[model samples]
Target: MRNLQGWEIFVLLAVVVLLFGAKRLPDTARGLGRSLRIFKAETKGLREDDAKDATKDTTVTTAAAEPVVVEPRPIESGVAQAPAAGAHAVHRDAADR
Candidate 1:
């Protein structure tokens, strides 16, 4: 597509002025500018937050570079293991009698 010529730009501005009126045009433009500024600021903040998150992820990965090996601890005397199914039935019958 070809670029907009000066005449096209002028016509578009004239149409906008006619549609919105001269009085409301400045207020509309100001509101549009404010919206753009707020949008830019939010996007910039999001980019900064994303950068921080990226650094955090990198540091976390590097810090845990070596694979961690965790050995299971032996069961203590105070903690009892569950009995076998057959043993449970026998125990239940013995208790009932």
Candidate 2:
């Protein structure tokens, strides 16, 4: 296979424009750009989530090594009680990264 040059790309685009009409070309281009942007955002979000998950797995192993069973505190009136500070705090620490 051969690499396409600038002129070749220009000619290809011109042919596409002629086939699709000048008015529809802008709309098609805009749609293509939006699709690309969405794809990039989704891919980046997945990568970050995977990294965060890997960190959590490592932290889980760390927590497993430390023998602890923290309990929940009593809630005041309408507020919900948070988990006790020992092992629960470690999970939060891993996720924050």
Candidate topping lDDT: 2
lDDT of 2 by residue, 1-97 (tens): 9999999999999999899999999899999999999999999999999998877745333333443456556678988766554635334344454
Clashing residue pairs, backbone N/CA/C < 3 A, model 1: none
RMSD of each: 16.7, 11.2
Q: TM-score of every model? A: 0.57, 0.52
Among all windows of ten consecutive residues in candidate 2, which has the lowest summed lDDT?
A: 59-68
- lDDT value, residue 6 of candidate 2: 100
- Model 2: how far residue 68 lies from native, Å: 30
Error of 1 at 26 (Å): 0.6
Deviating ranges (above 4 Å) for candidate 2: 58-97
Compute the lDDT for candidate 1: 0.76
Quickly count the clashes in candidate 1.
0
The best candidate by TM-score is 1
